[model samples]
Target: MEGYGPAEIEKLLPAFRAGEAGEAKPPTPEQDLLGGPATTPENYTLQLSQAQAASPVHQDATHAPPFLIMHGTGDTMVPETQSVALHSQLVHLGRQSTLILIEGFGHGFLNPGNVTELGPGVRLDNGRLEREPHTGFTAQQSPENPFELEGLAADHEMIKQFFNLHLG
Candidate 1:
């Protein structure tokens, strides 16, 4: 949902009169929808057409289905703020929502070509991350840090737990 088929899609696309923010007036009809004002020209015309039907954020979240949001703070394709906004809205409406932000990951984090440091020279192997020892990365993957590849495993575990909790 951070970058795809969610109600907030219009906000991330370059379309005319595309979408709305929480309780926000849709962009003027002449403006094109954008992730934010920075995503496009300042003079583009836009609006959140059929916003209520397009994005769930426009609807009441008091009765929304359980939600588990996983986003990467380093995502360049879609900012983590979008997840932040949706989660905030759900909380504000007293709905069940959880947001897990993997700090150093990006939108394509799972891609083999988008790899990053796991522990100094260490990296994920066979679905696990190994430290190179005597490296600065050892400190980077500490338990308190949810920004490392290990955090991704924790995130997956949490997702599984979230589903079990909600589904049962």
Candidate 2:
């Protein structure tokens, strides 16, 4: 539901419609949000700008909901710069917004649970991810490793608190 529109959605639709297996995973750049390596620089910029325009970045203070952006620092698929832009724009527009860049985390690492655990197939040799006992989520970091924000209980708590404060 988050970005990864059209092309990605098409891939998911058949799987849901048939209630069966879906297309195999595409390359990360194609499968992830804003991962468009559009054929050319002009094309990429145009597509990206168009997509960004459709996001909260285009919304003025009068036209957007409160934003709480949580992103991982080590995400290779979608970079945090996108969120940073949105948050910066929101703040500049005098809108209520928050951006939390979870260190030792990567793109779409947000998970809600009591503990954060590395999912299967996480390559330990990469040194990008480490498990957290307290939260059971991967929250550790190495100076040379990338980060991914696993959906962790602590993340969930933050989400809950945000909702309570905003929706209460």
Candidate 3:
């Protein structure tokens, strides 16, 4: 989804907070998918409001259902803190939430090739987020790594268990 960058964000925050339409401003930077300074299409405020309207995080999550949020520590596209904050909000509001932060895993870390490289990630099943400080095989292997296969199996089982506990 196309979005505002740091510059546009600075401009939009005031209007959004006041619940007003965005002011007319020329596009600032080259358009990029990573939310970098980009050429914003016409009607910037309209887009911003639309995005906020569609975003779950921006809306009222009071009646939200259970959530299984899995994020990679190495993900550059979106910081791990975003997921953490979401999980925190959900739990604070007496909602069911689970967060798993896989270490050394970048974007699309759930792929078979994306095995733990730095170490074991943390899990927040209870209230507190606990880090699992343990090293494992890296994910940068030419041939399909055995560690990847093993990791995939373990992850699959975890998903199954979560589903069974919640759905069954």
Candidate 4:
């Protein structure tokens, strides 16, 4: 249960369900400013072809438990299209899933509006990222801030409700 296999995912399920884990750290300005390498159309096509070739299809027809797939709209690292594609596949397979796209959010939920003073030396920005001056967590722009984009918390809540209805 170390990699991206079923066993690993199963082992993490308890913490995930309890909402005690899965919180991703925010990208620093340096990390955010660095753009991806340029890709030509041909290279893109080739990558897509390779991915399609390696992709696996779920063949099981049995009903699956409800799923909540949330993706950040501003996620430059992982395109939102990936979540859309997964949601589409789930729907095609007659599974129950809900996809929530949070606007202004990036790969992580860290946003300026979500910042809150945690303690004397700790601060949490947008519930998506934490800042500890001693630990090198500095003030920076985050995708989790509602002021960065409207309805972020609401969207998150919607996803929460979806999980509650299906999983609970």
lDDT digits (tens) for residues 1-168 of candidate 2: 121112112221111122122335443433245443344445555555555455545545565666666656555445666666656676676666666665656533443333433354432112222243122322222232222334544355556666766688
Give the TM-score (vs. native) of candidate 3: 0.50
- Top lDDT: which candidate number? 1
Per model, state how many residue pairs clash. 10, 20, 2, 10
Which of the predicted structures, 3 or 4, would earn the higher lDDT when compared with the native? 3
lDDT of candidate 3?
A: 0.44
TM-score of candidate 4 on Cα atoms, chains taken together: 0.41
List model 1 lDDT by residue over 1-168, tens digit each. 222124454465444333333335443312233333322233233334433345656677777776666555555555676677777777777666656666455554433443554444333222121221111211111122222234334334445555666676
42, model 2: CA deviation in Å?
Answer: 7.8
Local accuracy of candidate 3 as per-residue lDDT tens digits, 1-168: 001112122223223223232434422222122242223434445546554554445557788766666665665445566666666666677777666666654444444432334323432222111223232322222122112223432254555665666678
- Candidate 3 Cα misplacement greater than 4 A, ranges: 1-42, 111-154
Worst 10 residues of 4 by lDDT: 1-10
Q: Rank the candidates by lDDT, best first.
A: 1, 2, 3, 4
- lDDT tens digits, residue span 18-59, model 4: 332234543322222222111344443444444344432333
